[model samples]
Target chain A: MKRLGYLLGKDMRLLKRTPTIVILLALYPALVAVLVGLAVGRPPTKPRVAIVNQVPENKRDIRIGGKKFDLDKLTKALYENVDGYNVKDPAAALEEVKSGDAVAAVIIPEDIVEQLESSSSQGTIEAIFDSTDPTRKAYVENTIKGLLVDTNNELTNRFTDVSLDYINIIVNGGEITFGGETRNIEGLANGADLIKDVLPYVPAQQRKDLQEFAALSEGAKQGANFAKSLLRRVGQPIKLQNKPVGTNSSLSSLAVAVAVAVSAMFVALLLGAGMLAYEQEDQMLTRLLRGLAPRSTIVIEKTLLAGICALIVGTVMVLAFGAFVDIRWERAFLWWPAIIVASISFGAAGVMVGAASGDVRAASLASFMIGLPLTAAALVPKGAVSDGLYSVLQVINSIFPFKPSLDFLRAGLSPGFDALWPGIHLAILILAYCLIASFAIKRRVA
Target chain B: MPVLEGRDLVKRYDERAALDHVSFVVEAGESVAIAGPNGAGKTTLLSMLAGVTTPDSGSVELPGGKLGWVPQKAAVYQKLTVRENLELFARLEKVDDVFGSATRMMDRIELAHRASDRAEDLSGGMRQRLSIGMGLIADPAVLLLDEPSAALDPLQRERLWELLGSLADSGIGIVFSTHSAGEVEGHADRVIILDGGKLLYDGAPADIGPGAHFELAFINFLRARRAHVNVGGDAE
Candidate 1:
């Protein structure tokens, strides 16, 4: 229809004439990305750990194949091996772990060499661990555990395959030594990593053994016990400003996405409200209604204008995301349609306000109503949100094309969302919005 | 046959009637002027005839002719230059290269030098003339002008009269509404008078009777009627 072309042409012309609008559209993505960067964002890093070497001063010299090593040497090796982490000492080290400074702790056995030569199971080599920080603790435990095992295997050949016997020694009436020589206190040590001395890496607190007092059934709750202990140590309401979800390399991206979705929908609502409101204010609507030019022309033109603006904005956002956030654009082909649908759908809603309000100023009330709630999607993650609120948001988002487009963009960015579904989302958004906009047009005429 | 015919047309706003059983017809190629004071419904009638508003009760019958309408305000895009406004209208009306026509129309109105200025920046009289130029852009069989002579200087007014005379000579049926008796006396072929939503006179220019002082006269009549309603007294 001539009306349709008229509207489309006018919108196209406006876009061509206005350079400011072009700039506004372009900055949308970057602005949102930067905003999200401010909230819950930080750089990538490894865990810091502290080691306490309890070996005697002489026995600290533990030997391996052609490698004479001491606790200090292994500590140095661990430091050199790991990246982005520092090995700190007892006095200054783990103030972070104790004051929640270090992620984990490592302690080496004193008679480590003696246990390796004894060939038997008289005494055990050991290490005490702080289970408070799993990230740091896991790394310390694995490295020490693997190294001791290798040392134990090498020690078996040193005795020429003799029937495995052991050594015992006494000190202060305590059976400090067992099975063999009154030997070097060093001979009773284990160069090996395992230690029944492998006390279950427990926190320094909660020393009450379950075997002594607590219900056997209570200790039976394996994972629950760990959780209860950890909760007590950490207290409630844990918070970290830059906790990065495994899926995102940075938390800032999420914030940026939320802002973009919120703003785009807002602009859409405003555009729609202006359609009829402007005419009514200027008495143009009355002139329009009486003219032979027909009412459909006005609606079509407004819708087209909104669509064009949406395209420009969406394209700019897509480009910015690619440049700064490392977004994959090849898969972004579907974003175009989604943006268009959202633009027109929101624009139509705006027009509805204009038509209903009778003037531009009156349309502001409707803009506020539609925009505020729709912005919630930008504020909270879908999964973290309560089920009831999420459902309500989903329904509200369905009311406009912008909602679906934003959803698709986010879904596309996140892992596990297939490209096909986002494309489908975009299609539905465009078709549904255009239909809704057409209905809005019809209402304006009526 | 009449170029435009309406029978007992009625338009109601909420509970009150704006045009109550109004009837009129204009012959082809005739320049008719609608005369009325404020609230006399002169605008309401012109708007209806322009096809911008529809009658609730009566129907209008037009026999195979085009209509061009001009509103009272400038109604031109302020951001656009004069030449731009014309081309926009021309394109909107689907006329071919309406550019040439717009150029000629501008020269006729003596606005050729000011053609490059935005419609908003123009003087009030220039803006009015530009609005007229827009109405005549399509050069339809029927030209509808609402308050055409409003806010025009003497020279501009004379120029507008000459333009209307030329349009009438071209056999374009021109219908204009005005509160000015000078327009009706000097130019119009006939005059139709409306008073308080009623047709008080519908005939030749000579048939206006003695009511050239219409706005003052109508206000007095309304005042007297108001007094009669308040205090039981004879009125009229």
Candidate 2:
């Protein structure tokens, strides 16, 4: 191993002479951290809007097609707890929608509340929703839709309960002559278990249509009490909270920044590889091997050197942006080993490149081939692609040293799957790097 | 006892051979000078002896721990100061009082004043002195140099010869290659001559001193042999 030790000692001595690595890994981060602390913005969030009520002033004695009805209850539901509901010009409500001042414009027409007291499908209402953003638009539509559906469904259920229809049928009647005989009659009960089973799978809005179909099927055997019980049991529509995981703005900004930072580390890896390639081109590698050192020592020293370099760079990046500016330091010193593996992986990658081609440009090209795919894996989230795709990426990244350990970085940023997984990532890196180093050393160079 | 020996050594390059079944040996206190035409495998043989490059098919047996090799052009770290280069070799070789030894050797070779200069900044002769100083730090049993005097001026060459004479006096085996047959005759204990990767003569410098005339005759004999006519009407 004298030869390897000699090579490593030479490399370290060379590194000390140049000191380019110190500037890049250490100084750059310190500068970036200072800039980020000074310039980045910080604040909280708030949401609001304006509501307009279009109910007529004479709605207490309102007219709808020469018919008058009371509208007090409807107006109260529309105006209660709302930020600001004004009974003013309809044009001003339209202006609110145009100027983006309001999320939506609600108009409660005259006699609309009166029509709600009876069973008829001929009533129309207008609630103009702004179409600027689909997310806000969907939010307004769903909220308004929920209220209207509940009110209409309540009124319909009340009407249907009073108008309950049924039929009586005699299954069998037999006349018997005896000392004392009584007329015998039997009643038939409807089978509705099938409808109940199928009803859950259909959409909530389509449940009313199914109700009519079931009613028709039971005309000859309708039972009022059982149907009433079914309605009471399945009456409440399922509610989904639909609220997104966290504050949308922060989540997105965090995601984008993490992706960029991860990709930037690849660039750092490329620079390290380029340094190795330079040594190869200069014939220093051969010179080192010819010295008094073993092959294993040479490989270990190189790996250690690269690992240290990567740790320094990764820590700097975290200190600059990951910790103070954007995301806090989630994994302490975990990334140190992880980055070391990544560095070795890249260094070995470059050795293969430089050794094969005996040139720096070819080495860079080889590194780029590796960097591009890992960059893609890091940029996208776990579920951003398909399950099959994510599985394939996991396999690819398992063999890759840098790509897998990034999961630890991801975990540090957003707590996830398990910490044990980073260990897997680290183990894979070490195993893969050792395998490559052994092959390179054991394999014939010429 | 002989300090370095190689038997039936052969080294090849690509499909061609640079050394063809060459063999030689060195005694413990002898200073041997190797002379060869360009491409005659002198450097290759020196490298094999120094354990820098292994031959295609050969064996080197040295009853010792280490050998010092001074390749052509010094091949030392140019960025390092003279003291640092010596210190590094001293550290690796486990030479006690390395700085003291380095300074002593540098003084012996007249490199004391330039000890602080970067190796690259030193003159060719000064660099050669620095390299020899490094080679001697471990008190190597065998020292192999390739073209040690090729780039030095006449005065530097004489100075190196004096140093070599002193080293040989101290019972170190020195094997160096050179193109100057006269220099070999004056400085070397034994002169070995190579022609087309073959060793033609190996003996005392005085013996080869007379063979300078034989070298001319040999060249003529070889030319005439190539120019001979055969019964088949083609030049042999």
Q: Write the per-residue lDDT of candidate 1 for residues A98-124, one digit (tens) a residue.
A: 665555554444565555434464324
Isolated chain B TM-score per model: 0.82, 0.85
Report every candidate's CA lDDT: 0.60, 0.61
Poorest lDDT segment (10 consecutive residues) of candidate 1 chain A: A163-172
Candidate 1's docking class is acceptable
Best by lDDT: 2
Model 2, span A156-219: residue lDDT tens: 4544443332112221223322335644433333334456579889899999888777665555
Candidate RMSDs in Å, in order, are 12.9, 13.7
Q: lDDT of model 1 at residue A363?
A: 80
After superposing all C-alphas onto the true structure, candidate 2 shows an RMSD in angstroms of 13.7
TM-score per model over all chains: 0.62, 0.57
